[model samples]
Target: MAALAREELALHKLHTAEHYVSKAGLRETTDQIMEAISGVKAAVDNMTLRVDRIVENQAKLRTTRS
Candidate 1:
């Protein structure tokens, strides 16, 4: 199975505890955490794509200069 991310792990621990946990239940916490993870993953993906594009552009520029 895939490993849970840090935020997901913390949520799971919070839900499992007997008392003083966040008012949000497991499903709600899970949903919110998933949304956060999704946002972070999307940002990372976008950054990766942009970096790749930049690298390609640099290579093209270098080749043109040679």
Candidate 2:
């Protein structure tokens, strides 16, 4: 499930980045550039949450074993 979610999120990021780039005027459009940065921030956030879940599961397994 996590793998699938990660793949989907990755795809979304790719599409979003492309869309931002296509709209951003070269040497201009600071606002669009900032928006692109925000998009990347969101992607990072999504990946971080996924990693946190994986770490939590590992901790639970360790406790269960001991």
Candidate 3:
């Protein structure tokens, strides 16, 4: 029947649209996760830099005292 065929076509189109929307949402979530990881990496790098400076200063003090 023509009516049944038309209904099936509509449902197929709706299903396809839903698939694309879900894919886009997944991409957005992945991007947010990557951004958060980047932020944590930056923070860790800053701490490492500070610790290096502290160690260097201590080494210099030890040499001066000797």
Candidate 4:
């Protein structure tokens, strides 16, 4: 009976440790995903600014040509 109790206690500790490790892994994955999303957003914003400048330049050229 005493041996069985020891075995149960060991298993419980192992299970708890696994839970914490899993949680940490999930958190790390979420952080990486958020970082990637931020990079994409910054790239899109840069593209938008470049497009706006091009449009403005084209408009100015048209006026000068006229």
Separately for all candidates shown, the number of backbone clashes (residues 3 or more apart, or on different chains) is 0, 0, 0, 0
Q: Model 4, which residues run further than 4 Å from truth?
A: 1-21
lDDT (C-alpha) at residue 29 in model 1 = 88
Question: Between the candidate structures 2 and 4, which one is better when assessed by lDDT?
Answer: 4
Estimate the lDDT of model 4.
0.95
How would you encode candidate 4's per-residue C-alpha lDDT over 1-31 as one tens digit per residue?
9999999999999998877667688899999
What is each predicted model's overall lDDT from 0 to 1? 0.88, 0.90, 0.95, 0.95
lDDT of 2: 0.90
The per-residue C-alpha lDDT of model 4 at residue 4 equals: 100
Cα-based lDDT at residue 20, candidate 3: 61
Best by TM-score: 3
Write out the backbone clash pairs for model 3: none
lDDT of 3 by residue, 1-66 (tens): 999999999999999887766768889999999999999999999999999999999999999999
Every model: Cα RMSD to truth: 15.1, 21.9, 3.4, 3.3
Candidate 1: which stretches are off by over 4 Å? 1-24
Cα-based lDDT at residue 35, candidate 4: 100
Model 2 residue 36 lDDT score: 99
> What is the clash count of model 4?
0
Q: What local lDDT does model 1 show for residue 21?
A: 53
TM-score of 3: 0.68
